[model samples]
Target: MTEPTSNKPFTEQTVLITGASRGIGAAIARRFASVGMNVVIHYLQSHEAANETAREAMRYGARVLTVTADLRSVDQIERMQDKLAQHGLIPDILVNNAGISHYGLLSELSENEWDEIIGINLKGTYLMTRQFMSAMIERKYGRIINVSSVWGISGASCEVAYSTAKGGINAFTKALAKELAPSGVTVNAVAPGVVDTAMMNGFDASEKAALENDIPAGRFAQPDEIASLVYFLALPESGYITGQIISPNGGWLT
Candidate 1:
C-alpha cells in the first residue's frame, strides 16, 4: 500500500484520537495512516476493535499505537501520556471524537446518565486537550479537531444530553482556537449531519429514512467523507483556518 503522508514533518508527531475503535474514529485513523502519519488510537474498551484499527492503519506503513483510557479520570489520561513518551511519540494533532449518545425525554433521564454522557463527551474532550495540548504549544504547531454534531448547532428532540455535549464541544473549539492560534496551533470542529456509524445504532431503519428524507442531499454521510475534511483541516495550509465549526452535512442542516 502507498504510504499516507504525515502532517507533522519535523518531529515524529502523533495524532491522538479517542473513541477510535470503529466508525468515524476508525476512518480518521486510517486517513492519517494512509499518509504514513503516526496515529495513537485510544479506546475505553473494545481492545480487539482498537487493535483491528491499528492493524489497518499500519498497512499504510505508518506507525500505529493503541491505548486504553477512561476519559472520566485524570490519572488514566496521565498514564496514557507516559505511554506516548515511551513510544517516542509527541502528539501534534488531537481529535476529540469520543462521545456517547443518549435519546429520551429530558425529564426521564437519570443523574448517572447525565454524568456519563457529559463525562465522556464533554469532560473527556477537556481532559484530552488539557493533557496533550502543551506539547503543541511548545512546538509552535498543532491541530485540534473536535467532532461535533448537527444537533449541537440545532437541538434535536429526545437528544438533549447528546446535543448539549456537542454544543459544548463547539464552544470549546472556538475558545481554544483563539487561545492556541498565537502559538501556531489551530483548533476546529467538524459537525457532521448524519453518518452511517455505530453511533446510529440507536436509530431504527425508519428513523434513519426520515432523517435522510429531511436532508436536501437525500442521504446520510459516510465516515470517510468526514475524515477527508478533517485531514484537510490538519494541513499546514489550514493554519489560518482556526476557530471555525465546519459541518459536512450534505446540505442537511443548512
Candidate 2:
C-alpha cells in the first residue's frame, strides 16, 4: 500500500470490512474507494474474489488490503488484525458484515446448525468489534456499522436460528452505540430486506418472485443499494446518528 499523501481528510482513513469479497461487502468497498479511502477487504475462502475487489478499489485511487480468516474464531481475528497492522492498515471504520444464514424449523434444526449461524452472525460480530474497537475509542473518531437483516427486526418463521442471531446483533448495536457515544465513536446497524445475492440461492425463482411481490417496492434490493446505506453511516456527518437500527426493507415490513 502506498503512503497517504500529506493532505487527506481523516474520513479518507482506512476502513476494514469482513466478508467483503462480494455482495453488499463488495459494493461497500467500492463506495469508499470512490472517495479515496483506504479499505481492508476481509474474506474467508474467497481469496481470489477478495483480490479482485482489491484491484477494483485500487482503480478508484484507494489502497486496498485483502486478508482471509474465518470469523468464527477470535484467535484468527486477532491474527487478522495483526496482519492489517503489519500492512499499516488500522481502520477508522469497521463494517462487521460476515455472517451465514441458516434455514430450518426450530424442531428440525441441529446443534451444529445453531452454532454455525450464531457463531458467524453474532459471535463474529462481537469478536471483530471487540478486537478493533479500542483503537476507535482511543482516537475518539470511528465508525462501526453492523450489517444486520430485516428478519432481525421482525422474526421470520422457518428461519428461527438466523432470526435469533440477527436479533442479538440488533441488541448489540443498540447497546454498543450508547457505550461508544461518549468517546465519539458511533455504532449503528443497517438491516436490509431480501437482496439479490447468492445467499438467496436456496430460494426458488417462484419463491423469490412471491417474496418480491409482497414488498411495497415490488422488487428486491441490489447489493449496491444496501452498501450505499453502509457508506452513508460511515460519513463524518453521521456522528450524531448512533444506537439506531435502520432497516432498508423496501417497505416490506413497516
Candidate 3:
C-alpha cells in the first residue's frame, strides 16, 4: 500500500460502479453518494432500475449519471468511456461489480454457458480495468475494488464455472495491486458469502434455511454491510490496504 497526497476533497471524487442497477452494486453506489461523491451507475439493460438507483443517489445531493454498457463488448465499453468523458464524469474509483453466476455441475455446463460466465465475470473485468487504469496511473491515485465471491476463495460444490471466474478475479486483484501500487493506486477485491440478494432466488425456503444453519451467524449478509466495507476501502486514508481479498462471510470461513 502506497500513500499518495491528494489535494482534491473526497467529495469531488467520482466512482463508477458496474452492475449498479440493484443488489450489492446499488448499495455501494448509495454509500458513496451519501457522502456527496459523484457516482456513475452502469447497468446492462436495466434502464428503469438504473434510473431508480440514480434517483436514490441524487437524494444525497451528489451528481449521478446512469450509463448502459455491455461489459462483454469492447466497443460498448469504449463508447461508455466517451460518454463519461463527455459528461466530465471520468471515474477516480472503478468498481468492477458487474458479474454473473452459474450453478450446477461442470459436466452439465454448456460451451455457451461457460463462455457467458467467463466473458462477463473475467473478461469484462479485464477490459474495464485496462480501459480505465491508465488514467488512474497518470493521476497517481485511484481505487479499484472488485466484487468477488467466497466460492472463489474456497470453492463451492456445484458452482464450478462461477467459482473459477471469481478465483480468476482474486488472482487478478493481487497481481494488479502490485502493478499499480508503485503508481499510488490500490486494487483489492471484496468476496462476500451468501449475500441476501436476488441472486439467491433460486434457493427455496428449506434450502435457504439449511445454508444459513451452516453459518455461525445464522443469516445471510445484507448488501449494505458489504457496501460499508467497500466505502472504507475507497477512502483516501485507506491507502495502505491494497491487494487484499477481504471476505465478510459471517464467520463461515476463517
When superposed on Cα atoms, how far off is each prediction in RMSD? 4.2, 4.2, 1.1
Counting clashing residue pairs in each candidate, in order, gives 4, 0, 0
True-structure lDDT of candidate 3: 0.95
Cα deviation of 245 in candidate 1 (Å)? 0.4
TM-score of each: 0.95, 0.95, 0.98
lDDT for each residue of candidate 2 in 179-225, tens digit (9 for 90 to 100): 98888888999999998999999999899989988999999999999
lDDT at 201, model 1: 91
Please provide, for model 3 over 1-254, each residue's C-alpha lDDT reduced to its tens digit, 9 standing for 90 to 100: 43694557888999999999999999999999999999999999899999999999999999999999889899999999999999998789999999998779999999999999999999999999999999989999999999999999999988999999999999999999999999989999999999999999999999999999998999999999999999999999999999999999999998
**On a 0 to 100 scale, what is the lDDT of residue 154 in model 1?**
96
Deviation of model 1 at 195, angstroms: 0.5
lDDT scores for all predictions?
Answer: 0.90, 0.89, 0.95
- Encode model 1's per-residue lDDT on 64-120: one tens digit a residue: 999999998999999999999999988888999999898899999999999999999
Error of 3 at 199 (Å): 0.4
Show model 3 residue runs off by greater than 4 Å.
none
Candidate 2, residue 231: Cα displacement in angstroms equals 0.6
Q: How close is candidate 2 to the true structure, as a TM-score?
A: 0.95
> Which candidate has the highest TM-score of all?
3
